[model samples]
Target: MTDKYSAGVLLFRRGDGGVEVLVGHMGGPYFARKDNGAWSIPKGEYEPELEDARAAASREFHEELGLFVPAGDWIPLGDVRYSSGKGKKNLIVWAVEGDLNPADVVPGTFEMEWPPRSGRMANFPEIDRADWFDLATAHDKLSTGQRPYLDRLNDYLTQTGE
Candidate 1:
């Protein structure tokens, strides 16, 4: 089977406290009770054959967070591959420097069968909430598979002296 691919934007900003990243808490019941390791970069899966990765990233960023992505130079943070259940998947991410109030977020929604096997369908926000966390806090908040993007962003900033 072909591996699945996803693309996303890692929105960050530099402040007096240093760098901070905006991430979302994954919605739905499975992640409802979790905190640590439950947050993820705002993203969504896309079929590579049907869409360009960068465009897809922008689309997903809007869909997931209900916010217009800030205009800036998107610094490529590259991609990482990880196993998901029985299949492998790749995530491509780019870092863009910008700031926005988390409270302004109006997250989009997704429909899924709640309680796993019930016949009823429920709509849940793609992300229950969004917040800005300092680099260290962000490191702990992001899911393991997506954590490498942070390091990549740091390297890019360091190399450019940003």
Candidate 2:
């Protein structure tokens, strides 16, 4: 029952290989060398009391990837509750049909103390890279807690035939 809240948009597109989703590899030393489970939806923490979840999602998409959210209908994929190193977290996400070139990404960055305790501050991109992956691959790449949204998105697409 943590008070922290986050929201994100999962942009999907129909490709020759079938459905593909845009995901970003988390940056910083902790995930620099990691592959599976090191990627995430473009998202950020937000105060639920001050902003709508959908708005937060769109804002985070731009802030994280530096690209405007493509125009499309947003299908709510619902929320998931899970425990993180920061404690329990509640994340709400939506699936939108869209496409974009990964090379166009200009990721946002954050400054933090690096080397654990050297009292040195370093800047790192929030998302080092962005790319599209099939559902199976995305499942392996996305963080465990965020994986449920992919299932939800699949169910929605199946139901709507979209």
Candidate 3:
């Protein structure tokens, strides 16, 4: 019923007359079998005490992508809201330009019990795999709630040439 606020970055790099954005496939057993519409930008929740959602966003990006993202001028592309009746989530978005290598990426891992009741624990990468996709493909691959960030980034680039 209430809205929860979160932050994420739309990392992009120039490529072959267009731009490619970095989108991460969520890890863990829940998302291991999923494909389209399951990936998302590196992001997470933060409390007001944190005071800097952009900083939190950058930190989450580094942790999830296993690379440092400089805290530079962030192009605020506003937010996207998604609700499932149980709760509403607001995603604050920003556009960042950077180069990232999927091969070199070593996402952080979490220990979880596999096979549900088997009680066997295994480590899963925080982000199973990351890839760069053009705006159209990214829109389809990203989570339903996060597609807006790509749209907004495209609009911003069209309007600002950045």
Candidate 4:
């Protein structure tokens, strides 16, 4: 069977504290109040027929973060496949060096039936908050499946001597 796929951009920057990457706290009831494993890179699913992974990554970044990713050389981290409720999902990510104050992120919204059986729906930001975390801290905060992107970014940085 054909599995689903997703794409995302891992935006990082060097700061006095250390190398930091932006991660988002998922919204909606499911993730509310959760911390560890609750954060993820701004990303979303896209079909291969719709757009190439890179293009889909850029589009998903804009859609989830509510801002276009700043132009930069995107360092590919390749794909990682993980299981989801529906099936397996292949997440394609690229690391890009840039600066953005996560406090400034205006995440897009999604509507869902908040009370489970409630007959009403409510709108919630896709990401309730975004923050820049040092690599070590980010590792602890990121969802398990996406953690590899951090390792890939670090290895690339070391190789490039950045």
Candidate 5:
């Protein structure tokens, strides 16, 4: 068994429709045709010994979405652990208040052998699409492993009376 750790930020904003969050669809062939559980928070795994959780969250947010999580008080949503095949992935998420237009996003890209067994390599955006969705929509769109962040963020905000 292996252990994986990731850090990311959940950028939320208030609007007439209530709170909204910026999320992205997982790119690549595996998730290409899937919609329900294909989207995820903007995050990436990092070596825990090399960086603090919050700092890693900020870094990964920028790396995945090509934009910084706007400067603000980031409320720690704590950790979530989920099974990934024979490994476990633990994710630390922070809820930060921010607003950004999805149209302006410039997602980071990764190179991979698109057609398995073929030698051809191609570049694809890590997140092929991004958009702002209200909590309910986010819950429906985000992957099961990442959906807890939505509830955690709601709890934090409610407890703090934000």
Candidate 6:
């Protein structure tokens, strides 16, 4: 099977004496009714020609969040396998320090049929909502495999005192 890959950013901010991370809720009909582990970091797939997955992650964030994230220092948190069994080689993860305003988010759009087989087209936001959550809460809200990215971030911060 061909290997698939995607990348995401774990954006964090120091607040209330701890770090809080920003996560996004997937949009569209399939994910609309789900919660508590349905949300994910803003990310997407790209061809090898793209080369830089980190740049793709940053671009995807802008497309999904409608904001510019300065290319500051990024800490590589390695990669993790998704549970979907899509032959994903791994999800390249990174820790980026930045501030995001959930209120300003204007997610990208996708075209899909509202009612199955109805053939009526509609647009849906790439992400329905985004929020900041503490690590524990994020663990429950994020995909099971993606949780390691959070732990890796904490480990990096602890080691570097960032």
TM-score of each: 0.96, 0.97, 0.87, 0.95, 0.95, 0.90
lDDT of 4 by residue, 60-101 (tens): 899889888988999999999987668888999999889887
Name the runs in model 5 displaced over 4 angstroms. Answer: none
Give the winner by TM-score: 2
Which candidate number has the best lDDT? 2
Candidate 3, lDDT over the whole model:
0.83
Show model 4 residue runs off by greater than 4 Å: none
- RMSD vs true structure, all candidates: 1.1, 1.0, 2.2, 1.2, 1.2, 1.8
- Candidate-wise lDDT, in order: 0.91, 0.94, 0.83, 0.91, 0.89, 0.84
Kindly list the per-residue Cα lDDT of model 6 for residues 65-112, writing each as its tens digit: 887665577889998876565765568878888888888888898899
What is the clash count for each candidate, in the order shown? 0, 0, 0, 0, 0, 0
Question: Which tens-of-lDDT digit does each residue in 1-162 have in candidate 3?
Answer: 567777878889887859899889999888888888889898877774655888778877888888877446689988778963359887787888888788877898889889898999989998999999988888888888888888788888889866
Give candidate 4's whole-model lDDT.
0.91
lDDT of 5 at 115: 92
**lDDT tens digits by residue: candidate 5, 1-162:** 769999999999998888899999988888889998889899998888988988888988898888988988988888999976558999999988988888888899999996987999988899998999999999999988889999988888788888
Q: List ranges where model 1 is wrong by over 4 Å.
A: none
Instruction: Report the Cα lDDT for candidate 2.
Output: 0.94
Please write out the lDDT profile of model 1 over residues 3-120, one tens digit for every residue: 9999999999998988899999999888899998899998889999899999999999999988978999999999899876558889999898999889999999999998788988
Give the candidates in order of lDDT, highest first: 2, 4, 1, 5, 6, 3
TM-score comparison, 1 vs 6, better candidate: 1
lDDT of 4 at 36: 93
| Candidate 3 runs further than 4 Å off | 70-72, 84-86, 117-121
